[model samples]
Target: MIRTGDEYRESLNDGRQIWINGERVDDPCNHPQFKPVIDIRARIYDMQHDPETQGAMTYEEQGERFAIGLRLPYEQQDWQDKRDAVDLVMNDIGGVVTRVGDETIGEMWSLWDGKDILNEIDPRFATNIERHIHQCIKDDPFHVSANTDPKGDRSKAPQDQDPDMLVHVVRETDAGIVIRGAKYETAAAYSNQAFLKPTIANWGNDKLSDYALGCIVHMNAPGVKHICRTGFAGRAPEADYPLSNRVDEIDTLMILDDVLVPWEDVLFYQHTRAASFIRTTLHRYSAFPFVQRTLSYADLIIGAALWNVKQTGLDKQQAVQEKLSELAIWREGINAFLTASVATAEKSPNGLLMPNQSLLMSSRVHALTNLPHMMHLARELCGGQICVTPDAATFAAPDTKPWMDKFYSINEEWVADDRRKLLGLARDLLNSDYAGHRLTFQLFAQSPPFAQLAAVYRNFDWQGPLEFSHKAAGLSDNVWGKGTRH
Candidate 1:
């Protein structure tokens, strides 16, 4: 059941429609923009089979090996194992990349927990989700998510401006339901499938809507066009933009032009409640891994900032130490949330163990809400040299090499080349275009800031606080009996 790197590489040759920078990608695995990340993803697959990493990255059941990341959780160890696997990958890769597979599979599990809603809406497609969960375990396909349609104008109704702005069931056919719309999906060009569904939380209490549909979208299926944002890999020298070149997860504005979702692939159809249910609980299980990625990212940021200070001998300053403490506070805040979430893990309605919702969601808010500030803090610690530093070419030019060496070299231990490498890493991690794009990705990847807060509001135990306040204030018995309000 386990796949090798070559099998993953060959799987993308399914003639999927992929476009980037106005050019059709003939081979995404070898395309300059996608090749770096594709290779990273392939390496993750290979790591599962490598004797050194196979033990950590995979699990054996009945003498057959399978991806640990794809295993369905039933106990707390399942989650801890997944966490260790993600950490191993981050360490091995030497940087961070999100939307691989583990991060997005939680969306599917969220829906699986809503099977009762699925069954209520349409009995025919109820079992589709359970089947696919097992399919992922068996085939080890790369999965991603599809939500957030480009609702052209929020002021006008979907029908008034353009119905296609939201993905909807155009019509039901003998083969399946035909869908037309576009979604901004990260890694869609390279991923095998996406759990396509609605992102709008408010469905106006309507019973059935064409917009309320969920299905499994095959990336290579007919009419699926992956028009990707221009990638950062080949745009600059790897020496100057190492993280950008190595870990950029390309996003696609995936267009579904009347794509068919066979009955077997449809998870829910024309049911607003199902859509609402999914929109509310989509990140329940996935937020753990999503937040975990932020933890690795925090480490990278902290390392860059600390090393920059150490390079300039500024770490000894009390003021500089204060700034480093602030960064650590943010880092450990994320760490605490993740650790506590796992320790107090809860079971899903369907029997799968998931991280505690309150801590997990609040962790997402804390991590993302303060991300820009923390990134800016790290940026300050790194100093202005990161932004003003020239590319690797200037440092290597024959005439400028001596001058560059004189200015960049710090001491006996830190030479010009090493200094340039550190500055390059700091620049790419904090100040580059890729850095800004990634910041935005983390901000809204799971959902928007407002939605993230809403999740926290929904999951948090407000009753406990209210009860405590009520007791402290010596509220009347009448009010104490009511849940949150009299």
Candidate 2:
């Protein structure tokens, strides 16, 4: 049931009551701010059906074909296949932020829902999983992972926050449960079909027990509301600002007021312990796939930066060449880790192929450490021209054309307009609100950078390495002791 890009686009025409700012959006499909992101996601759907990418997106199992995404079990080939799929989509969208937009979240939610059924307390959960998966494959619906709660204070639990800050179950019935509160900083909520799993493990506590609820709901459901930020997409014309024109996936704040979730849609409820399990498990599963995406994004940025350097006549300078070399090194480092993780993938007990845990953990840590540095390096290499470049309108202005031509022309190689366009694109990458949003996303996607490093340290097989060192030094014969570290 692989969906085509057109099929995916048509699905969004469903009557979903999504709001931007205070107004109820009558048609999200026609919304200026949301249309570009929808188009970007549609491109991802198109990738699955594309001749070149079909191999990466679909896999054969039991003589039946299925479109594989980041959620597939850890088969040996699955890691690289998923990476290739991610690259195809990211490159088409022109960056990494869109990679997080809707496709990834939908795939992730489908995976978690499927896993919940197989690992369930009730047999009926399996039916729910099957039903959900079928719906996803057929509709290719967009979704947002509403996992982070708005904690009033960093040190306190969800109960300590204003009750409205965390979505929680307020009433239970034989049919379902009613919930109220909000999920903060949710990306692409306006374009999604439903939000999956609002509370992650960190917020679990006795006082916050109801907040541990998990479920899925249609965006148009009663009592559900979405508040979006001022997006770059809606800011200006593409002719004047090319970067923000075609790629703003609006981030949002979602509020639920007595929202009812049917029993069929509830993955977990009042199971606070399961919240932590879900977080750890999802982190283990998603780490490497994300690295694959970020690395691909870095690769594109590196290419663009190098080209900008050449266009600016700075490529011949030793300092500039050295900076480009560093960008290359960073790119290679990310790629190496991605390759290692894929090569080391193993089959999960559920028959899903996933990335190697150790390598995946390392990749996440490396991304936290390296992405900002890499982007900063890109900005440095491109220089002040990225920020000071004139808009397209100014370049086309008759009065400014001659002076603009003389000053921007470099070495009689690239045309003044060409240089202006390149620098404008670079500015979009480095100086625009889009750039700021990307940095924010990179910094907060999983958790705080320190927390990510801690998870890596926690999951790392340090004792195994230590044992190998000891054995090599003839200090010990036992390597089994390392297994108990976790």
Top candidate on TM-score is: 1
Model 2 root mean square deviation, Cα atoms: 3.5
- lDDT of candidate 2 at residue 179, scale 0 to 100: 91
How many Å off is the CA of 416 in candidate 1? 0.7
As a whole number from 0 to 100, the lDDT of residue 211 in candidate 1 is: 89
Compute the lDDT of residue 325 as modeled in candidate 1.
95
lDDT of 1: 0.91
Query: How big is the positional error of residue 396 in model 1, measured in Å on the Cα after superposition?
Result: 1.8
TM-score of every prediction relative to native: 0.98, 0.87
Q: Which ten residues in a row have the lowest lDDT in candidate 1?
A: 199-208
